[model samples]
Target: MADKIPQKCPECGGSFTAKKLTTTCPHCGTKTELGIDGNARYAYVAPKPNQGKTFTATDLLNEFSAKHVSGPGMPDLMGVNKILKTVSINDVCPESGMTPLHWAIVNRNRAVFSLCLARGADASKRGTGEYEIAPIELAHREGLTDFVDRLVSHGASADDDMLRPIKEQRQVAAAATRERAAVVKETIARLTKEGKRAWYQEQVKHFEEILGIKSSVARGRGIRAFEKVPVKSLAEKNLGMEEWLIKLHDLAFEGGATLFCEKGLTVSSKIRLLLAPTKSVLDVVAVSNLLSPDEPGCERVDIGRQLEKLYVELPYRILECGRDGVLGDIRAMPDDLEGLAKRLLDICPHYGQTLQAGNGKPWEKVDDVTAVKNDLTESRGFFLTWD
Candidate 1:
C-alpha cells in the first residue's frame, strides 16, 4: 500500500519526489501532511516529510484552474493538467466533445485561460456545440469580450460565418478570383513580349539560291547585301565587332572556315565562329604585331597562327576573371564555351599551361607561342605539342 501510494505536494498540488516531494506548496504557500489514515492532506502547519497529502473537490478544481495548458507533446489544456500527480479534477471534468480552450472559456476561469494560452493551446478550434462555435463565439455568446479579444490576437479568424456562402456570393467570388488570375497572366505575357522586342531585331532576307531569284535580275543594295556570301565578304570588308559576330555566326553554318585580317577585314568587326553546332567564345585577340605587314601566310597557317596569338594573350584575362575564386559568367558559361576553350587550347603549342591551370593545376609560366613552338620542334622532337 505504501509503495502504491502516490506522492504529491499538497500546497500547489503538483507531483513530488519521495525525498523532496514531501513538502508544502511552493506556489500557494499551503502546508501539507499525511493523516493517521496514511492518506495525504493539506493543513495550516508546515508539511512534514513522512505525511502524504489528500486532495478535495475545491483542491481539485483549484489545480484544474491553475494548470490549463498542455506541456510539450500534450495537445490541449486538459491532457496536460490531467496527467499531473496532484490534481483529480481533470478526471471529474474530462472534456468529451469540447476542446480545452472551449472548456476554459465556458468555465470563465482566467488563470486556466492564461495558462492554456501560455502553453500554445490554439484558441481557434470551435467548441463541440450545435453551431460548431469557436472559443470567441462562446465568449461572444456569453458576453466575454476580453477572452474573444485574446482569441483574435492568437490567430482566430474574426469572421465566424466565413465557411458559409450564398450561391450569389460564391458566383461573385469565383468571378473575381478568375479576373485576378487573368490579370496576372496578361501582365506576365506583356512583360515577356516587351523584353524580347527590346533585345532583338527581326529581318527577312531574299536568298537568290534558295528562292531561284537570279542575281542578274536582283535590284537595290538590299538585294546586293543578300547576294554576297557573309563570311567571304565580311572577311574582306570593314565590319564592327558586333556586326562581325552576327555575320560570323551566319557564315560558320553557311561556310566551313574563313580567315580575316585587320587590313582586309576591318579589326573592330571580326567575330570568329569557332564551332557550327554550338556557340563558344574560343578566344578573340587581334595581334597586329604577328600579322605580316608585307606578306600574308597561307590560309590554314594564318588562321592557326591567329588562333595561337589569341591563346597567348587571353590567359591573363581569364586568370583575372577567375582570381576572386569565381569565374563568374564563365563558370555559368554555356557548354559550348567550355568545349571551344578546350579545343582552342588543344591546337596551340603555347596554350597547354593555360588549360592545365584552368583545370586547377598549379600555375607555371608558359613562354609565348614563338619561343614554345621552336622548343617543341627543336628539343622535344614533337611536331604539334600543345605547350
Candidate 2:
C-alpha cells in the first residue's frame, strides 16, 4: 500500500501527494523530505553524523535571520551554531549584505555576538548596503563603551574619527564638574560671611569632595571645639539664667552658629561663647552675680556690666566683624605674633584690658603686647576682659 501524504515542494512551491516521508516532488522532480511538521517541503534533509552537506550562502543567511528575531525569549542559538559550523562567520547575507556579526548586533543578541567573536569574527569588517559600517563604529554608535573597548582590544583600528565622540563626551562631563565646583565654592564663602558655621562647614566638606583638595579655610576645628550644654539644663541649675541665654541663642542662630542644644546652648558651666567663624571660644560672665553667685571661679558681675559684655561688646568684636576683620582672618595666628597683637590692639584699644586665649588659661594683660601675641598664637582662641 502507498503511504500517500499531502506535501508542498520546497523548490517549485507546487502542491502534491508523496508516496513516502522522504520522496521526490512529482511536480518539480526535486528530491524533497518531510519537515518537522510532516510536510515534505524542504529540499535538504538533516545532516547525518560525520557527513558534510552542501548549503548555499543564501540558505545559511535565511536560516540565521529566521531564528534570530528581536525581543524577549531565548533565541535559537544552537541553530545559529549549527549554521556557523558550515559557513564562515564573516559570510555576508545576500539580501541584507550583513555578516553574521552584523546581524547579531542588529538583533542585539549578545549570545550570538559573543559566539561570533569567540569563533574569530573580524572586528574590522564593514557590512554593505544600509549597515555599511565597521563593527567598532557600530558599537560606538550604540554607546557601548565596553563593546568598543573590547573590539579595540581585539585588533580593531582605533582611528581618531572612530574615537572623537567619546573624547567630546568626556570633555563635556569635565566642564560640568568644574561648573558645579565653582558654585559650591561661592556658596561656602557666602555661608562663612553670614556667620553660618554649621551650614558653612557642610558646604566646605562638599566642596572638598568635588574638587579633591583640602581647603585652608577649613583648617579650623568645627563646632565640636565647644562643649555642648543645653539651655534647659542651665535653666534647671538657675531658672533666672534661662531668659538671658534664650536671647543669646536667638542672636547666635541669626549669626549662623550651629547650636547643639535647644535654645542654642553650647556654653560650658562657666559660660563659654562660641565665635563660630573663627572656631574661637570666648569666656563670658553670667548676666548678673545673682545668676551664679556661689559657683567657684565664676565671676559674678552687676546686671548692667553683664548686659554690656554679652549684648553689645562681644557681638561687635567677634560675631559681626566684617568678612575681612581681624578675628575673621584669625583661624590660627601667624608666626609673627607681634603683628597679630598690633592688629588686635588696633581693633580694641581700651585701657585695663586683658586677653585670655582659652578656657582655664591665665589672662594675658594687653599692656604686655608680646604676651598677648604669644597667647593668641598658641591657643588659636581669644577672650577679652576689662577691669
Candidate 3:
C-alpha cells in the first residue's frame, strides 16, 4: 500500500493519519472507509447494527415503543438510550398516529417520556382517531395528577375537550351500570327488593361496629346514602371520623392500592373498600376482623397478599412534593401519630406485614398490625421537666 498520508479528516476537519481501509477521525470519532479510488468514504453517522441486520430508523423507533411499554431496562438494554438523539422523537404510529412519546405516556413510562420530550417530541402531536387525543388529555383521563404536571411542564396545553373519549367512557359506564341494575331489579320481585333493603340496614350496623365511621361516599356527583343506616361512609358528620376516612383514601392514592365498590347484595347501595397495598396486611387479625364483620365469603384472618411488588418511587424527580389533603391529597400526616404505617413498612418490610406460609418463616414478621393502627390515633406528645 502507498505510504498513508497524514491529512485533515474530511468528516470532522480534524487531522489524522489514514492507515487501515477504515480509520476514525481521532477528535470526532467519525469512521472513514477507503473508497474504490483509495480516498476516504464519509457517512453522516456510523450505521447501527440491529441483530446483524441493517437498522432502519422506523425499526428502531417501533422497537423502542415495544420495550418502553414492556417496562424499564429493556430500552437501555437495546442501546435505545444512546441512539435517542438519532431516532425521530415524533415518529408516528401508522395505525394510531401516536408518537413513541404517546405510547410512553399511555404506559406511564416517565423515563422514556421525558427523554422523548427533551429530544423534541412534538407535544402538539395528536392521534388521528375519532378522539384526536393528546397525551395531556390521556394523562388527565388516567387521573394521574403527576403525569398532568409533567406534560404541562413540557408545554402541553390542558384544555379539556368536550368530545374526549374519557367522557364517553364515563357515559358508557353509567349506562351499563343502569342497564345491569334494571335487569337485576326486574328479575327480583318487589318483595325481594324490600327484603334486601332491610337486610342491607342490618349489614350496615355490623359495618359501623368495625370501621367506626358515620358513612356516605360522595362520588363528586353528590353524596347519597340510606337515611336509616349506612355502610362505610365518609360523611364527615362526625368530626374525627372524616379524618380516618381521608387517611384510608390516601392509602390508595400513595401506595398502589385500589378502591372498588360492589353492589350491596340486597339494596341498591355499594360496599367500598381500599384493597391492601402490599403483603396483604388486611390479613392481620384486627384488620381482617374489621373487614369481614358479618360479611359472607370474607374468611377471618385470611389475608390476601398483593401479587406485584408495589414500589413507591419518587415523582417528576425534578419536583418531588405530593400533598394536597383535599379531593385526593394528604393534607398533613396525622398530627398525633407515632408514624405512618406505610413509612414503617417502607423502613422495615417485615414490620407491618403478614408472613407467608413457611416462606421467610425464619425471618421475623411482627404481628403488631393493630398496634400500628392504634399509633395512627395516638398523637405524638412532647415531654418537659424531669420528675
Top candidate by lDDT: 2
lDDT of each: 0.36, 0.47, 0.41
lDDT at residue 343 of model 2 (Cα atoms): 48
lDDT string, candidate 2, 227-262, tens digits: 333333445454444344444444445544422121
Give model 1 RMSD, 1 decimal.
30.5
In candidate 2, the residue pairs with backbone N, CA or C atoms under 3 Å apart (3 or more residues apart, or in different chains) clash, namely 196-256
Arranged by TM-score, best first: 2, 3, 1
Q: Clash totals for all models, in order?
A: 9, 1, 6
Count of clashing pairs, candidate 3? 6
- The best candidate by TM-score is 2
Q: Residue 141 lDDT in model 1? A: 73
| Residue 52 displacement in candidate 1 (angstroms) | 24
- For model 1, the stretches where C-alpha displacement exceeds 4 angstroms are 1-95, 159-387
lDDT of 1 by residue, 122-228 (tens): 66665444526667777777766667767777877766443232234456555655554443344334333432341211111122343232323112101111222
How would the candidate models be sorted by lDDT, starting from the highest?
Answer: 2, 3, 1
Q: Write the per-residue lDDT of candidate 3 for residues 1-387, one digit (tens) a residue.
A: 567766455445666666676567788875555444333444323336454454334454555543121222124434554455555666565555666666776677666676677777777677666326787777777776556656666777766552344455556656655554443233223322332354434444444454555545322211112233233344345534334444444443354322222222123233333222222222211122123222222222211121012112211000000010001122334543444445434433433322211122211112344434443344321100100
* Candidate 2 accuracy as TM-score: 0.29
The TM-score obtained by model 1 is: 0.23
